[model samples]
Target: MLLHVSPARVGFFRAQLDTGRSGLVLCGPKSLQQARRLRNTEHFSGPLLVDPAVYEVRAASGEEPFPDVAEGTFGFEDPLAVSLAEQRAVGVTAPMTPTGYLHAEDSDALKAAVRRVAALDDPQVVFAAPVDVGWLREEDSVRQLIACLRLVRGPKALMLGGQRDPLAQHPRAVDHLRQIVTEVPGAALLRTDLAAFGALAAGAAFTAFGAGSRLRHIVAPGERAEKSKGFAQSPHVLFPELMDFFLGKTLADRFAGTAAPVCGCAACEGIRALDSFASNAGDRQARAAAHNVAVLMEWLRTLTALDSGPARQWWWYERCVAAVAQYPLLNAQLLQPNGFKVPAQLKRWALAAPAAVTVQPRADAKDYGRS
Candidate 1:
């Protein structure tokens, strides 16, 4: 799928996106206009925008923003906004990010609002899980996610959330979320938080990270507003290439003896290994970005071409799971010892860090994905 990793703003970005893929994810703050523009670009058949409320959470520690909406739900927009997004072939993704509780009443109010957002019948509406919730609270988040999923029962209705278990640091979240994706019937897409991409090998589903690393390769978070000229400030900074590399490597290594093909895209077609491309900063960064995108597209194409058979199932259960399980061990390789690439390294660090255990594992690990 054609995935446009962009910030949440509509007016900020002006880049030419690659659109041959099947889907697009607009990361960052939510913007109806930006969503429409993405749809107009044809890079994605249907674009999914991560909600703005994720950044509004107010910390008890007394951060700058008192009433933090960082973990808040998207109740500000009306159904018209969602409809407008549809006009541009983009979809709206709302729901909580799962952070600290503001108030019991407010939480309930937010839950009610989520239900209302899901109730809207539009061509593009995906109710993703709250991004702010702690992984230790997966049960609560899952319960809330289930409620939102129930309201949006159409074929387009998809579910999304960050991870909470096993590889909660890296690829484990993918496997954990995969259980939800597999079990959550009718789920069209899934999303991973900034930290989970490296070892996870997650898919066309929602993926977000810092902006500088992907589009402009911004070094400092403070430079986002000033330096982000032709790009959105949202999660577009975090492109899908992070996870794509993991998945592509897994596919190449696991199914090595089989007909599993290497990506024919410009990046991997004539290349031997990922290291063949110049991945260093400056001129090298662009080359790495190009190769990363190409490799990702190739993986998605192969995945899309696969038949819905036992092999696919086995792939998800075995290789996919194994890759995620390896997140903790493979994390060091995700980083470069060199400086100037700090931003990307930080994001990878988040994905590889261990998460506290909270949710009770189901009887069978397979139950995680059984619909």
Candidate 2:
């Protein structure tokens, strides 16, 4: 239940922190100064991860020429140097090395990155990669990456980045993620969306998603920016029942009935109707974001309480099944001709076989990264 928010939007999460349910806060490079200030001055004690976002710089093509972060933008030529700077700035004990998106065909680069990171000799280091989703779909690529990952003596994390949503494009993305987690006992999935919950059920060490749409998925190099120039973007409201997010205005239009769905999260205080989130009021948008985090945190707590692997898997499976069942009735209520299609990822979760339940002892810092 990690929440990824930009520096500007971090204040909106005060309500979430007050509950003490939020796990970790992840922000991009630009947030280094603010994050450090919060830790030193505000006395905020939660774990804060400042991602260098080197992947954005590396993923850009010659035409784009570092579309997001240009060379020397942060006064460092090496991306990992930028990440190390963030670690020092925030005083994080466990450091995560900055990495770039590696394509499936580039086995040489993958092995090189793994070997280089392992040479750092930091047992607490987190070896992370922004991987192309094609690797998940290709068995050979998954095997190759997993083998290389085994050589690194540290915790490993993968971020699926591309032009389109990996979970939507690759039907077996969750299955592949499960395989990786099974092979690498404490692997993490970062910068993801609802699919992360499935990863948790599959025994992933950690998972994170953005507070807004832009941070939810990592865009590949050369992909066109989705945001239009002048139009103001509306916050996306998460529909817990449907297990999907809809634009605030779109959700409002769909629930034209007298009673729209209502959220029971602490942020909403069990009184805010779903359509109310569509309002243009500034406070309403913040409330909507808070509501989203509350719902996710509550679900995470519920799953964690079900201690055994089998129990968690069964609980998540049933939840996905229920969400899939709601689409047909929702379309009928809206008087639309099947306008909504169940998300492929949700459908996969409902239909996939439950993974084998195993009990593995937690790996400590000393044991982590050992081949």
Candidate 3:
């Protein structure tokens, strides 16, 4: 499985390449434009995919072609952006969950949203996450979500999206996805955002975790709004699993060192000490982001190397479940299969919405809010 990590900015691409992890996703013109300058007009070799910013599909109301885009044109129309995407990207995607998560039972609603994406002639990938699937307590709901994926054909990548931060959305998300591609011949499951690496063991062809704190966590599809203020830089350290963010310079320093939990990614492994990651300026934030990706890369490499057999994917599924369940730190972030119940508010859409799931908190993190 290829673990594609996002660049925190155009500047971090080299750090990733220097580490030998490729297929860096250019978030858009914004990230791409800057990357170009940083490279001094150099070209990136691995497959580049453009996130067309269409993750949300319109709801069950009147269906239209990407209703969320301004003036009905996806920003991909920017001549410069289009040229760059076409020149560099393996493909471009319409947001898989443009209308947000759909109830597992709401097949009609899902078809309405997915039809346009399936019909597109451009090299495309389906980027969707079943709504409210995290709190899923019933097995039938899982079957229904798999059915929705089974319906999609002629696809490039089956990217799983829409889970909020720090919570395992649908515990069976990776399993069902593994089953889908096994039965369907065209596409491979590509999971993104929180817990994506875990999905890799469950059979993701490619998986990505957020490169920065801002990109790491997401509002549950149902709860997100149209607008929000940009986040200011803060002193924070990315923990293992990329779920929880511990905010504070002291905490960052304490956890970052050869003796600490930090991984030996290409970027930070060379840094001599954690104290060097002081929180005085953007340097701290950049280092933190690089460190997060580095550790994530190292972690993924380990998973990929665990088994070489045909059953390798299942090798991960079993390994991660047993491994995380015992490790207090991992359990603090992710959930074990059939582990816990989700919040009442989050569970409201579990069986009813077009997409949904719910999960309980780890023993130590009972105070964490379920998004």
Candidate 4:
């Protein structure tokens, strides 16, 4: 499991690191300063990925500006220079090559970015592509991406970023990810949510979810900004049993009940109902985010403990099936029929075929050079 670090929740993430449960920690351009502190600490020895977040630059220049892209955050015209410098400053030994969201039709741009990264001479370089989500819907595009990825000659990893929530929107997103990972080997889904679990079951090396809802998906360029409607932003609390997140206010208003489920994660200890997370008490948001991470990490541990690929896939399928089953029970508990809309990704996960075992041994990074 990969945890995307947010600057505000650095302390919470630091606490998580103390548990030694972290796999890969991803930090964005804005969080690099905090990530530097984490990297210099004794507790966090795991690999840290400092994402240049080139997609934000693309978004800011598009029809609808991404609100999150603060002016002058990525001041440089070339994101690669900024990316390499940031990684170096943070002491990332093997930095990822930063690239913007590639349109499927722009094969030349895709090939150029791939070749550019490959030429960087980093033996363990990661080729990161922030792609348009539509790529998954086009077979020719998927094939084009896979073919380009195969051209990397040395030890490398692939990090895929998509515009919006592809797993929820695209019917075959999971299968397409499986196919890509099968051909590309070391691939990770970036800026995703619970769908990352589906990618894991589909044979991805690991996947990342941001600490907050806004960071969960890449909002498409030209998309209108959502109106706040005078309500303060609330934390998105994950209900692990249901494999989904609920806004804190929504949980309190609708799901709070004597029979409401409780989380057993360390962060949630002593909390009677998950709805209690809705309270805006001191550190509630941070604590709630911690609970989300803890529960997901626990599930990751359970999945990884299984002996074979088929066993892991079966376990994931069963988990999805069980989560889906809870929708009706939750509706019944709330006395509101059809309160919860089952996520399409969750349903697809339940019906997914067992993945074939194709774990490949990673080549040692003997030399940080592009072959």
Which candidate comes out best when scored by lDDT? Answer: 2
**Better candidate by TM-score, 1 or 2:** 2
Clashes of each: 46, 2, 28, 3
* lDDT tens per residue, model 4, 1-371: 66766565656645544234344445554566756776786445676777666665563223221123444765444556556675778766456665665654567667777676667656566666667666777678889888877776543343444443556567876777778876776676766777677667667766776766656766554554353332255667787778888777777767655456766675676464677766566878777777777777677666555643566566677778888998898788788887777877778777776645564222331211110
Candidate 1 regions with alpha-carbon error over 4 angstroms: 1-4, 7-21, 29-110, 121-123, 133-144, 154-176, 188-265, 271-281, 321-371
lDDT of each: 0.36, 0.69, 0.43, 0.64
How far off is residue 80 in model 3, in Å? 19
Residues 276-350, candidate 2: write the lDDT tens digits: 866656787788788887778778767666654666677678778988998998788778756567878888888
lDDT of 1 by residue, 1-371 (tens): 33435544222222322344333445454444566554566443443544333322332111211233323447664433433344344434332222222221234534554554455554244443333223314455545554444555442222222222112334333434444444454444323323223222223233332223332111111122233232231112112222333222333333344443333455445544433322233444344445455444444444444433332333333433444444443334434233112233333344432323343222233321101
- Give the range of the ten consecutive residues with the poorest summed lDDT in model 2: 362-371
Rank order (by TM-score, best first):
2, 4, 3, 1
Model 4 segments more than 4 A misplaced: 17-30, 41-43, 59-82, 153-164, 222-233, 279-281, 355-371
- lDDT (C-alpha) at residue 22 in model 3: 40
Reference-based lDDT, residue 257, model 3: 37
Q: What is the lDDT of residue 244 in candidate 2?
A: 85
Q: Write the per-residue lDDT of candidate 3 for residues 201-234, one digit (tens) a residue.
A: 4445455555544344333334553232222424
Higher-scoring candidate on TM-score, 1 or 3 = 3
Q: What is the Cα-based TM-score of model 4?
A: 0.83
TM per prediction: 0.49, 0.87, 0.61, 0.83
